[model samples]
Target chain A: MLHELQSGFMAAVLTGSQTELTSVTPKIREGKLNTAQRVAIYRRNVQSTLRGALGDIFPTTRWMLGDDKFLNVGDQFILHAPSTSGDLNQFGRSFPEFLSAMQPSAAADMAALDWAWHEAFHAAEQAALDLSRLGAVPAEQHAALVFQLHPSARLIGSAYPLLELWQAHQNSEEAPLEISKILPADHHFLAVHRDDANVTLTPLSAPQFHFLKICAEHQPLGEAAEAAFALDANFALQAFLIQTVQQNIVIDFNEPS
Target chain B: MSPHHQSSRPPHALDPLCAGIGLRPPHYQALLGKPAAVGFLEIHSENFFGAGGPPRRYLDKFREDYAISAHGVGLSLGSADRLNPAHLENLKKLIDWLQPSLVSDHLCWVGVNGRYLNDLLPIPYTEESLKHVASHIRQTQDYLSRQMLVENVSSYLEFADSTIPEWDFLREVAQQTGCGILLDVNNIYVNSINHGFDAMQYLDAMQGADIGEIHLAGFQDTGEILIDTHGAAVSDAVWALYASAINRFGAIPTLIEWDTDIPTLDVLLAEAEKANVMLEQASFAMPTREGRRHAT
Candidate 1:
């Protein structure tokens, strides 16, 4: 009996249809509000709540889709991408991917960037290893030095210049954003991370992205720099190292661990 | 390591006799420099479950000043599906760090079958559900190594086969499982208005010994039904019900929860001040069932 009520009720909620509610209908009391209206409240709550969550977590997506379109997209995302976790923050991890397939508005690209920001906002805090400490290491060890990305840092690659697109949309003083008109036609690489709880999205050169990606993969510095050099002959290993260390991108490096 | 991880025990005990207000972000910056005169602070468990960042930092600092209660909207304590071990683990990790005075979630299920509905969906008031929910509570309490108070959810619909009343099911869950209650007065009032039950009777029905906390919030009337939006000030009827609840249960830790359209901390503290006044002005402020338990 419990199984019937639960499955039936859940079906009604997910489908927004009353077909399966017959068995559960008798249990509802005859009150000022009828059974369907009562069930409709739950259905609406589920939609509105999840939609509200997606909007909060992925505001850039909402902005791209506009209010109604985002909600419409949100509903479809709901039907296809069921929230698997109890945390509302954890609800929309798949939304960006879902949007990527659902619409052509490039909302998915923005969603992905937005999601990265959200994750970086919550990622663990780790103090980047001191550059002077690395410099203190013997020059011979420089090749073996493997830099670790800050725990809060994430690298994202996009066909669209998501960081610029995101910036333009964020500019309240700028004219109302039209993605096609303003977004530069270029592939973009960026890193998202939190410094003192301020989540930032900083653009990265292809060489920088490769270097960091390889290092983040736990490769030795020799190999990581080689990967960067492959991407750009003028990878500027010395200067990049200084910039990354100051940015706290490379934290607590050690021998192969 | 996270600053919270540095602590082995909570800074202090949550005084279960004062008023608290929900802590949201808009008021976070102001509270940092000049916190309101709130008796304690309450927060949704998931809000702080982030790996580590500013939210954690603020909460770590806030814990030093006031007792904290980890009120959870997730955990889906009554889901038919096995309780999410990951959810429990995250909460356990948080408890280890925050060491809140009390830990609680709704006496409702939010998800099932690997699909998280994310809203507190009503559970049927039946023996089968009672057993399921009780077993889940036992598992949670055992795993958490602490008591968990479950609050009732305001519902829009009722089950026809429900032989037991909501008040009875809630009381039975506490009685059988040895758990505590976080009686939400606004939920009671909202349910009373929607389901045609006497709010006073609902309060009178709860065993005083079982109630560990009291929740006060506002509701929205969409002309047809009252929704527990938690976006407004406590309605007059809810205040009246709370007064009745105070009479039956005596002074307990009451929280003024405003989730959406959150006002200034001044506004939140004002609502909490009202609850504090009720706590002080209670004619039945004498120790009831719970007070005796504490005494002996």
Candidate 2:
């Protein structure tokens, strides 16, 4: 009976429908506030809490869409895809996909980048690889070594200039550029990672992005370099490797067994 | 229950009479630059569920000076469905890491049927619900191998099928599970107003309860009902109630919890100082229990 009441209360809160309240309303005491009013308060709290979680993660998207539009979209998404986890941090993983389906716009791309930045901010902290260790490996064995990206590193390729969009929204005083006015790139690659206390977004060229992507997939250094070379004849593997290692993106490496 | 593994680290002790504040992100830098004058810092355990990040880094930094309280908001201990193992695992990880002076969550459910509403939803005060919550609390204490404080939540409505008083229900759950009570004085005041019960009566009933910690927070008055928003300053009435709680419970570790529209470190510390004043004025001294354990 308690389970039945909880199910009914949940339905009443989620659906906000009178029909769903038949089982719940009778079970609620009639005080200064009627059962409907009392249930409505809970419904509001649930919606606002979920919306606040989304808003916190995707502030750039919220700024792009403005408060009213964002709230409307957030309300719909709350009903469409209710949170499965008790942790609010894990609530909006599918929000960008939902937005992509709802409207194929740059805002959806921005939401994806926001999600990436959020993940990077909260991902496990791993130590950057010591270049000396790489130097110690025999030059011949280096080809077989599989490099790994930092646990917090995420590679995102988008059609929109997400890094610039996110940066533009950082300063609340500055007016946001119109999405139509901003030029969309054919392919924009980015490396999102947490450096110490801040989350940083570094733009990447196609070859560089692919190289890191390959490494992230656990490919050997030689294979990743070859893939990068295939994209561009002069991919500059050594220079890029040094840059990534310095940036603390490539955190560790494993030798071939 | 024996700890799954004993922590070699020494326990961080908190003064039972001193007040503390909730550690929010905005005041991290400020708190770190110059540690606030408080006994401990309370953090919502779920916020640091991530493997590692700035939160964990800052918490570690704060831990050096202050005792930490791993207060959880997502355990859903009162839900009819079975407790979530993943949530329990994450909570255990945080507790093991922080080894907080106190760990607590609401005496209410946040979700059921695997879908989290993410709000402190009230539960009916029935024999069935009491047994369910008590069992979950027991399981949680066993899993974590430590005592946990369960706090009362403010509710706008009451259940028609409830067969027990709220105070009796909370007391019975603690008695059944051997869990300590984290009495939120503000909630008692809010619930008293909304449900037309005497606030002093609720405190009177909890006189002998294992009051491990006290929560002092602000609430929003919607004219018709009081909402535990925890945004504004703690009201004079709630302060009065907190003083009464301190007098009754004998200087329990108090925390000034501000979750939304969080103010600067100074403002929170000021509120904590207010609670500290009350704590200092207490004439009685209840024998403080160190890590209230669950009965095996």
Candidate 3:
């Protein structure tokens, strides 16, 4: 009865197909409304509830899609994804992935950035690696020292300027997003991280993203710098390391741990 | 840490005599600037389930000055596919960290077979179903290592196959599991209008020692049936029932829940004030309603 009752209602609500309602429809009394109307109430609630979740998680995506298309995309996603968590915040983890196929232009880029922000918001807190802590280490150990990114660190790359698009949503002075104005080759490497205290998204050059990404992968300082230099021989590893530590992106480091 | 809790945070006591309002995001700035003149604060537990951030920060700040109640919106306790271990783990983590005065979720299941609806779906009130839900409640209590309350959800429709009334199902769950009842007065009123059951009878059936917390929230009248929106002011009918519920249960800890379309903090405080006044009136208005044993 549990499988029969829940699956039927879920199918009816998620797909708007009445075929599955046969098992539970007769159980509902039609005093003021018929079976369809009664089920319609739940149908509407489920849609609005799930759609509202996606809206909260991806406000930038909502700004891009407006009310109608965002909802339509959400409706289709809800049917396929079927939020597995009881937590509403955890419902749309796969929505950004689903947006890749969305019509009226896919929001894959913006959704990716928003998903990064969403994850960073809930990521665990850890103390940032202090440069002074590294100062005590012998200069010879610098390359072997493994600098780690914060637990919430995420490096997102996009062909479109998603960081710009997402940042534009925050400013009151910027013109409303015109997707048409967005160029495909506007390559962006955005560093999204939640330090123990704050969450931020900052643009980085390709070399910078790769360097930090390699460092985030637990690569030693030397290897990470070499990888960044591979993109461009003149990559400023010292300046990048100083700025990252200041931003608390490069938190703790270990000596061959 | 004790088996009842996994975290090292100490337990905080909640004053059952004081009525509080749901602390929402809209009210955070004001409340954080200066703690509101209310008894305590109530928040949707899931809202603070995040690992860290402003929700985490604000909740910690609020806990400094006020007692907190974690009213969970998810959990889907009655889901036939067994209690979600992840959801339970998150909840226990929160309880361990926050050490809230009280914790509660719904009597209805949110999803089944591993797919969550995220909405409180109605469950059939039958002997078999009753046993199923009760077992989940018992399991939850054991895992959480403390007694928690189960709330009665507002449903627009009822199943014809239900052999028992919702009130009986709720009461039986309390009796069988020893979990407290968070009797939602507005839900009873809304359910009465929608399903044509007597709200007072629902209230009367809930007169027990297990009745611990009371929730008062607004609902929308959808022309055909009432919807528990919790976005408006508590209706006159629900207040009247609160008066009755107070006489029946006696000055239980009441919470004003405003989830959506949240008005200003003043409006919410005013609603809390109203509940406080009714609570005051109930203290002296009528004799103790018999058969109502409150778990102090």
In model 1 chain A, the worst 10-residue window by lDDT is: A173-182
* Candidate 2 deviant stretches above 4 angstroms: A172-175, A180-184, B1-8, B207-209, B284-296
CAPRI class assigned to model 2? medium
Q: Candidate 1 on A60-173: residue-level lDDT in tens?
A: 777766788888878888888878989888988888878767653456788888898888877777766666787688888789877788888888877777776678678853
lDDT of 3 at A82: 93
lDDT string for model 2 (B1-296, tens) is 11222245665777766788998999888888776468889998999988777777787788878888989999998898899999999888877877788899999988888888999999999999998999999999999998999999999899998999999898888888999999998999999999999998888778444888888899999988898999999999999888777666677788999988988888888888887767766633433433322112
Q: Tell me candidate 2's fraction of native contacts, as a decimal between 0 and 1.
A: 0.70
lDDT at position A152, candidate 1: 80
Under CAPRI classification, how is model 1 graded?
A: medium
Taking the tens digit of each residue's C-alpha lDDT, what string does model 1 give over B173-244?
999899999999999999998898887777767888888899999999998789999999999989998888
Stretches of candidate 1 exceeding 4 Å from the true structure: A21-24, A103-105, A173-177, A180-184, B1-4, B283-296
Instruction: Report how far residue A238 has shifted in candidate 1, in Å.
Output: 2.4
lDDT of 3 by residue, B111-183 (tens): 8878888888888888878999999999999999999999999987777778999999999999999999999
Chain B only, TM-score of each candidate: 0.94, 0.93, 0.92
